[model samples]
Target: MLLKVALLFAMLIQIGAAIIAVSLIRRTRFNGSWILISGGFVLMAIRRLFDFSTLFGNAPVFQKEEVNSWLGIFISILIFVGLIYIREIFNLRDRIDELRKENESAVLSAVIQAEEKARQKFARDLHDGLGPVLSSIKMGLSAIDLQSLDQQNKLIVQRSTSATDQAIVSLKEISNQLSPHLLQNFGLTTAIESFEDQLLGNSDIRFQFEATIGGDRFSYQVEITLYRIVSELINNSLKHGRPTLIQLSLSQQTDMLCLTYNENGQGFEPDQLSEHQGMGLENIRSRVKSMKGIFQLESAPGKGIHVTIQVPAK
Candidate 1:
């Protein structure tokens, strides 16, 4: 009966240790607690085994018997406390993670909504300010050209025409940046391709883009969020990384959408930098968090940087 009780106690301690180990794996913050709990349980199990062996063997001497009994009680109490504390720590970690996720979702919703409002304001400004001004200039120039004029007046008309043309170009650029017409008319893939072509023509950096979209449609907010995020990433690469070659890949794997970018540039340690140090990276992180996505960065000194993001397909 004593042997069976000892074996049962040993099994319970082992079970507690197993549970603590699994919790440690899931909650990264409880590593030290797990180690202490696991060690204590192991010691208790060993002590119980020793106690069982002694009981089944030649009787222990008085001195050894008294020492064993005291040590066994001490170890058992330590093991029980350690297991309970570890469990409490695990619960705390889980709660923290849950709260963090909720906070991120709230922040993301605010950011995207704010961006949408800004875009609308910009579009309105272009239509109201630049659009009408350019139209008036074009009409006024046509009126001037129609009148009989000397060579000098013709040159003035030509200059006015050139200025109006430049203003039109500027307005077009502003409009495109505020809200890409292709994005509203067609879809994200086409808009991205158009932007890529324009970027490649203007910059010397070589960029490769691939899209393996699962479906033909996405929410307007999602499209805009992804567009801004990608734009920010590319801008960061250009400004900091100075990479000659950059690759961007987008695809859907099952129910998750993935975006990955790799650049051949000098990379810095992410842990070493403060959150506010890189506005571009911070923006990317915020955008990813808003979308309830997973963001990861891999980089080392003298090595290039790789950023991978995954979000659930909604």
Candidate 2:
């Protein structure tokens, strides 16, 4: 009698579990797979009810062989359906991850573009306003008649004129760096070449640029982004490392455009980018990721820095 009671209790618990499963799943989508799952649970509950009836009543409605066969078929169907449910869950998870990445990239891309627009506007303001004003001041100083002044006054005027000239030159250089016309008009390659030439001719720093790309240009956004990244790297190398030699390469392979840069100067920990990374390095990383491009950085304390980037033609 005790054994029979225990069996009845176990069967009741299983039926209850099945009822819960169906109720929960029914709250979700009603598809073929869900129907199979829900139906399997309902069938299991009904099968248990029939078994319970035999324990309490005089005779069984179904024979043991008949009940066993139905249970086997139902179990097989449930197993198959469970596998499909697991696979569907995995597929849905993968799709969600992909959508998340796309949304992140879109947000980052918008931020980088907004920053570029701000830089362009600020550059224009400097070039059109302060730059011209400074030049005019230099010219006015140059026009001053120092010959008619006393010796001490003439010397003061001369020194002031010299200072004004230097200031004008500095303003123009800063304005150009902010929004280079070459980058907008000539594309990335030529703009980079011009930058290299200007820096090399004026400063003691040495730059070697190699390009296998043709005159065909990337999209304006790509060209400008690449130019900004390169410029930041160059400035960092010059300011911090004082690297005597910097090497840059540009080439096209398959559907990708590649850039490789190396500086023969004291490098920093690549891991420290998060701690000490200024706007420049962070911007470079953000821009690359936003474009769905790959960026590789290798550096150590005593060694030099090497960076490689691969961006799609889009």
Candidate 3:
């Protein structure tokens, strides 16, 4: 009977040691629950050793067999409870990560929608405020040309007319930049081609464009967001990169649409910039997130920059 008790105690000690070792290894990184689990296993091991030693060594122990059995059962319950808690901790961590991703996506969508609304408002204001004012100035100048005005007054009118024309042209450019009319009339491809042509005519930098868009038509919001993102990237390259060559490409495969750009210019570390800090970069990310898309940037000092965006066609 004593030998059987010793063997059973040895088995329990081995199981307890294994549990303690696992818990200690898991707690090496300072996890509190693992430490607690290890403590529970240690207590069970000590209780089993005492019970076996008293049975084998002819010691007159105070505790009865029933009391020792109850104690063992209690420690076993504690170990089982600790394991359940550890499982719950892991599950909670996974849920927190998922929630964080969802929250980020929500915030990005809100920002992009807000920016689009602001752009539309600015376009409307320019049309309503400056467009009519310039038109009136032109009419006034034409009326003066038909009147018997002095030479000096005629020159003043001519100068005023020239100034008004210049103002009108500036306003038109601003309106177009805010929201292109070609995007509404033609399509994303035509609007992009027009942008490329305009950039080539205005800048010394070489511009290259390649597109293989196969979609029938995209929503206005999608087209505007994409156009704004591309335009911002071009502007950034011009102002900061000072690249001699710029390449823009677009394509679609299955349900995924892709836009990529590369510039041979001085580039900076992308990791150092905050997502919501740079206006251009922020807008690009916002637009991508709004479309439930992925945005990636590859850049290093003096190496150049490459941006790739992919979105599902809906």
Candidate 4:
């Protein structure tokens, strides 16, 4: 009795599965593969029903034994071919995904290159157009005869000359920022060290930068993206986090270049930040993604912040 019950249960399960496959034909738009698979399921369920009926002794046979054997073989062929078709569909989908990623990366690289070109143009305009104008003004002011002028007028001339000199200095600083000559001439490590040197005595924060690799050059995209990412992080810490110490390290392991940055600052809950907030973190993430790299950040309220970035060395 138990064997009969178990056989009936299995028949019901096979019948239900066949029903499911038939229903999916509509969703699959009657694709040939799904049609084949559905047919296979239906035949298998019919075979199960035949087996269940045999438990009752001398079960009715509507077809010859040879006919049933051929049907079973047909069902097996349908299922095998349908599964092969489904596997090919998955493979095609994966290929499409890879192409999409490559296209996105190419677009991102072009955009970054255009941005760098604009920066270079702007910097060149400032250096060539405005720089000499300020110098000419200072020279004209110096040529004035202070000896022939009254005391008050002499003082006015001196102040004007001093102000012109300061303006020239400020112009140079802005031009450098727009397009960093150091970064263009030197590699990543030297550029970072130079930036750290500029910030050394300006703030109370203790900044430490270490690079395990020296004078190693990478693709322009990799070096520039990393420099901008590091600069953004440091600026965020100074502007808001009030960190007393910031440490950064760069190293290369095998074919990967890794960067680690830490700040002992008043960190906040990362989850609390809205989509529009968080110190340009989304920008940083996009930059990392453009290079097919990884960006991981960790922080909590009062626990400080740490970040790790890894990209292909090539």
Candidate 5:
């Protein structure tokens, strides 16, 4: 009788475990391992039930054992209570993992913000401090009367004035590249288009920018991170990939903002890239993670490179 009770209790526990595992399948994202565990529990319960049914060898003893029947009922109730605790344990674990990711993202976001602040300060100082000083030097040169000077002095003054002008333009360009004023005043699309214009004027690379979201604005973090990512991608392509053509597209899908970039370049295997070759891609991945976004890269030797990123618009 005690043996029969033990078998019945084991069957009850197995069935309870099977139910719990099956219920957690969705919570575990239907993981294959969890599915197999659930199946194992179900098979064990079935096997135990078969053994318990045949324990009496058709003597009809199972129904006659009233004390064993009462014990099975008590065990079933205990297993039911235990399943609830098991589920709560899984929930607590998931919550802790979520909190950990949130903490990491928060730290990364803080670091990026601080870096951007530094860039802005430096750009502002260059524009406000050095910009005017260079302009004053150019103006003083412009005020010189070249007519009264000899031919040699006139030529020297002309060269000096031209060099000063070039220096002023180069300084402004540097300041703009460090911290884009258009990105601060205009939206992301406008800023990207402005960058594209500069590239088109300076390089042989054919660049394209398309935006389905028009001029809609996102959070500052999203805008700046995306802008930096685009810049880095282009720089990588020019310096290594040697791409003649680059295309970028931006769109809003549901609650997410999607970005797609491609370059017709000499691509290399992403998995086999050296540390220096992979660093840019890794930086892009980290930036996406900081925004809690998804980043995907596809590249192969001679196949060109493609990248996709999606982040929450909110």
Candidate 6:
């Protein structure tokens, strides 16, 4: 009787644990290892139920000495198999996670490379094609002998020249925004400061930019990646948030570069990142992932927004 009670208690515990394991695996994302782990737990639970039945119930297999020996051996074999599977599940899960990250990183890198190539092509067209034509137009207008023309004609020419000048300026600015040469020549710090100046002039925002990395330059890819990231963050702040001040700081440690950005504006809930899917946010994250970097965001309504990024420099 005591043995039967113990067997029943063991069976109940195994069933409870199996249920919990199944519940967890069901709620989680599906994968082979998860299924295998869940199956192993379930097998252990069923084996316990069989043990209870063999000990308590009048089963013919338990009644015969030789048959009982074979039944115990079969049960032992299943228990060993289940344990082996459960043990291997850890290694399988880790391998799957590593492969997933590698796959994601490769996809993002390809997309970013394609984007950079397109930007380079567009910038070249603006700088080489439209830029020269606009400059010539400005020069031709200047060479026009306005004194020979009637007063009304001279006013028209002057206005046309002024509009042409503005157009040329806009073209240069837009081209630079696409891909800045300063980043490759001067370094990350100069490129970022120039961007801040542009944003400062175009909007009612104060930018405080600082860099402690000196004038040391990184590879063109890294420089451009960081530049685009910072530029986008500032653009988002200006476009979405009613902010007065935006602050950015950069520093470098051994093999790692860190950027910290803050905006004093109407911020959103931090949890929204998990609950909501925002393209702008996703773009930022994808860029960081391609750089093999870490991105973090902190925000709350009516308070402010803070972002910290760390990327490998080497």
Q: Give TM per candidate.
A: 0.67, 0.76, 0.75, 0.87, 0.74, 0.77
- Count of clashing pairs, candidate 6: 0
The CA lDDT at 267 in model 6 is: 86
Which ranges in model 5 have alpha carbons more than 4 Å from their true place? 1-83, 150-155
Whichever of 1 and 4 has more lDDT, that candidate is 4
List lDDT for all candidates, in order: 0.78, 0.81, 0.80, 0.86, 0.85, 0.82
Q: State the displacement of the C-alpha of residue 165, model 6, in Å, after optimal TM-score superposition.
A: 0.8
In candidate 5, how many Å is residue 263 off?
1.2
lDDT of 4: 0.86
Model 3 agreement with the true structure over 130-166: per-residue lDDT tens digits: 7998999898887875368888888888889899999
Q: For residue 103, what is the lDDT in candidate 4?
A: 85
Which candidate number has the best TM-score? 4
lDDT accuracy of residue 103 in candidate 2: 92
What's the CA RMSD for each of the models? Answer: 9.4, 4.7, 6.5, 2.9, 7.8, 5.7
TM-score-best of 2 and 4:
4
Task: For candidate 5, give the lDDT of residue 283.
Answer: 85
Task: State each candidate's clash count.
Answer: 0, 0, 0, 0, 0, 0
Those runs of model 1 whose alpha carbons end farther than 4 Å from true positions after fitting are 1-93, 271-277
Q: Cα deviation in Å at residue 187, candidate 2? A: 2.5
Give residue 59's lDDT in candidate 6 (0 to 100). 70
For lDDT, candidate 4 versus 6, the one ahead is: 4
**lDDT, model 2:** 0.81
For candidate 1, write residues 182-301 as lDDT tens digits.
Answer: 887887788877877876668788888889883476778777778877888877777777788889988988878788999988888877866554878888888888888899999876
- Candidate order by decreasing TM-score: 4, 6, 2, 3, 5, 1
Relative to the true structure, candidate 2 reaches a TM of: 0.76
lDDT of 4 by residue, 10-76 (tens): 8899999999999999999988889999999999889888777676667446554655797799899
